[model samples]
Target: MVITEERIEQALRTLAPVMRRTPMVASRALSDSCGHDVWLKCENLQRTGSFKPRGAYLRIAGLSDEQRARGVVAASAGNHAQGVAWSATTLGIASRVYMPIGASLPKIAATRAYGAEVVLEGEYIDESLTAAHVYAEETGAELIHPFDHEDIVTGQATVGVEICDQMPAVGTVLVPLGGGGLLAGVATAIKLRRPEVRVIGVQAAEAAAWPASLDAGAPVKLATMNTMADGIAVAMPGAVPFAQVSELVDEVVTVSEDAISRALLLLLERAKLIVEPAGATAVAALMEHTDLRLDGQVCAVLSGGNVDPLLLTHITTHGLQAAGRYLTVSVNVPDRPGGLSALLELLRDQGASVVDVIHSRVAGELRLGEVQVTVSLETRGPEHQVALRRALVDAGYLAGE
Candidate 1:
């Protein structure tokens, strides 16, 4: 059955005590940037730091007494595993989760903390899910998919219901799509309530399957999916979710890796919020949308906040490079100490902060007595970077043209 309004309402009631309704926080910075009244549905604050718990709780709540006794099994990259583990434990039911080997450490640890048996299996979420399905069939444990099921979609639709209640003025909803469960549910709710409001789905360009799936009107698996937004890195949309997304979703947009990193940096630095790459994908769409028509009261669902600390660090550095604040320059100077000192003095005068200095006496086509010195500097922008290079050149150091 399709996700109905009544089903979503019941799911909300079932999950009321277990799930956080989360906040709809206004972002002046985002609004000013996009020229829209932007509000973030911070599902990153939901139980398990993701909206996955809503669906998982509702799915577990649907299990019969017999199924509950047999326990439940699920597979996910990270967020969905934690969601299922937490929900099963809350209901006093035993749970087992199979996760990809590449799943984040924080997610695996969180799943373990929720009183579930964690199984690290396979290379990607699909493989893990396949293993879980086999285990469930062999052991008779109930299978709770991260998406694809009606109960899960209905549970995810609760977000749409809460958004309507919290912000009746919301005219558009932007959501990140992996298997499309969240988007399907939200689309059903908004379409049923106010068919006028639009539902837009954002996917990582590097790992986009929905675009082709929607065009073909079927779920097509990808041979590979390479994206930093691991949360939405599904190789193919689910059968059930594909139907709903193809039918209800108004548009499916893709965001580049660079755009996602930039959005994550913006959310962290300017909004003071920690959003994973997948969670920030919707905001990335808002920033990079070629069409200027989506500028009204827009709500972007931040689906999860489970980024690894290492990934966050990389995203920050990459964002700096993307924004032109960081630059690398190669300078040819005499292989002497004082020669490097003179170049440093000019850089100091140019107001550029030196992040790293690598001097090599024997590499990259250097002259007999001259060494190649690469200076990585932090500058304000193109202008500051230009001035820094100019100052270095005016002093007779051969900075790369």
Candidate 2:
């Protein structure tokens, strides 16, 4: 059960044919903002659209002949289900996966396509996990946990080895932490080889459990957790990973939901990388906590990219609003024939792109002859937003945000 340098290398050999050596790309935008050489470990591009396959493959491959015959079962919301399904299919083993009813349709289809019987069970992951455990107990099937086993951690450690091989001089590494499989694995691998390199773990602020767990010297389960980063919203740290993370990880940081959305937006716009919120948490850490002033070459692991398109649209809009790139303003103008026309002219002159407008004359707060107009405008950024509002006020319109 002891994960070491030799075992991690063995994992690389075992995964060579199944997994990819995901690209390590330099990010000019991140580098310029952080004031350091920054690179992105694009595991988002990994098979099954995330790094889950690495651990899933390694764990299932080590099963005994009798165990393989009994098959494997796992519970997950999305990414891990597909990972286990894909890995099991590749190894020619029968696999059954339980997913929460709310799991995205595309993810469910993907898991089924990977040759696993996908069962929709429960409303959340905890319920699915319960069902999976029961199935395992009854059928004598091996239960493949997402991130709580030594074999899983050892498999994930291969990412750290690859990072070191790709960027030999990396001074710091940032990883997204949920149950800590990836963080624990990467930190162990890096620290064992380059003890001087610092490893930081990032988690969604709303779902963070490690800070409290580390303080209590054990895994601590939360009563509730709400975060858009479903991939890293683990309510409790796994016992196996908690042990390694407490010793090998240099620091653990939490990023807000707003920061995660903004980071995802930046990754899409600047780096042209499609990353889920959990994958963007490390980038969010870099965007936030400006006081950290990280030194030397830094690498942030982009954990996964299997985001639902509808969620992507909503988060993109949320990010835009947070960045002040989109604004909604209310104004009262004369209820005349040219009144709305004049307002449109003003917006045109200010170079503001009008996305929506609602004009009403029966508003409760409307004056005797005035009408209320709600305008949704898209601007260049915060500074442009300020200028546009100022222009609205100076132009003799009662503008309010």
Candidate 3:
């Protein structure tokens, strides 16, 4: 079924009082970097910490009384699970949500807290989806697919409607593509209202299926998917959303894992926003792709913020490395107590904050009289890292990789 602007407007009316009309805030940092008037669609701050609730609520609300009585079931890595759980609870419908075994702990906890029975199964979203389908068939529960149905797409299109209404001069819109629901819905809505606006979809390079599927003229499945952005790590594109995307979306692009990490860090540090890796893909694409003609008002949707704290630390470290703000260096010094101390002094003089220090004398590369002192330091940026390394080498110390 085709999702129309009218249906999106209807969904907006239904969700207006309940859903948060997430802000579209100007991002001066991104604007300067991308050479465009950049704005952030902060759906990360939406209820349930993602845009999933918009569709999930609409899907559950449209169910018949008998269907609602039988309950609802869904499968997601994290965001959608919380969305379905929260929506079902609000509508007084019982919910069972299947999530991957390695799904974020906080998301799983939040889903259960939303009054849904949470089932941990499989290693990825597809496997969890399989288990959900089995449960739905056995219990006669209404299965709410995360991004494939017309109701879900129509619901998500409300984001585009808001963008058009909020930022009338917006010339380009970048949305992260997972199973393509957000991209399909947003593109359809925006194009229907303002056909001149360019709609672009961004995907994680590691788990991207849309590019291949678009090339093949059908939904294509990946053999394996691996990425830090577990939220957008769908192995296959949904047929329903794919059709909408193929028709409405102007372009689809991919961003590297490092790019995503850097984008997340940028949002955290510069924008003072905690954004998940998947949600940062649109920004990542804009940052990495200098060829994009984003001269006019451009908006990148920050789709979700349901990141686990532990994972956030790892991603932050990765981002620091990607940005050249963190450095690890090893220097050979005399095998003495003061040897490591001397190197630490040098690092301090170089304006590098030492995070970790390790001293070893039994290394194969080190001589009998020499100890290897490895220091992990945090620096200002690439120039500071370069200066620190140069100073270490000029100090007559063997600074090896």
Candidate with more favorable, higher lDDT: 2 or 3: 2
**What RMSD value applies to candidate 1?**
1.7
* Candidate 1 per-residue C-alpha lDDT over 1-401 given as tens digits, one digit per residue, 9 for 90 to 100: 37777887788789888788899999898898878899999999998889998889899988899999999999988899889999999999999999989788988899999889999999878789899999999999999999989999988998988888888988889999998999998888888887888899999998999888888879988878899999999888999888888888889899998889888888888888899999999999988885745835999999999888988999989878876789998888888769888888888888889999998987878779998889998989878877877777777775457
Off by over 4 Å in 1: 290-292, 386-401
Residues 24-113, candidate 3, lDDT per residue (tens digit)? Answer: 888999899887899999999999999999999999999999999999999998899999999999999999999999887899999999
* Clash tally for model 1: 0
| Alpha carbon lDDT at 168, candidate 2 | 94
Candidate 3: worst 10 consecutive residues by lDDT? 392-401
> Positional deviation of 241 in candidate 3, in angstroms?
0.7
lDDT values for all models = 0.88, 0.93, 0.91
Better TM-score candidate (1, 3) = 3
Model 2 C-alpha lDDT per residue in residues 4-23, reported as the tens digit of each score: 87889889999999899999
TM-score of each: 0.96, 0.97, 0.97
The candidate that wins on lDDT is 2
Q: Candidate 3 versus the native: TM-score? A: 0.97
> Candidate 1 local accuracy as lDDT?
0.88
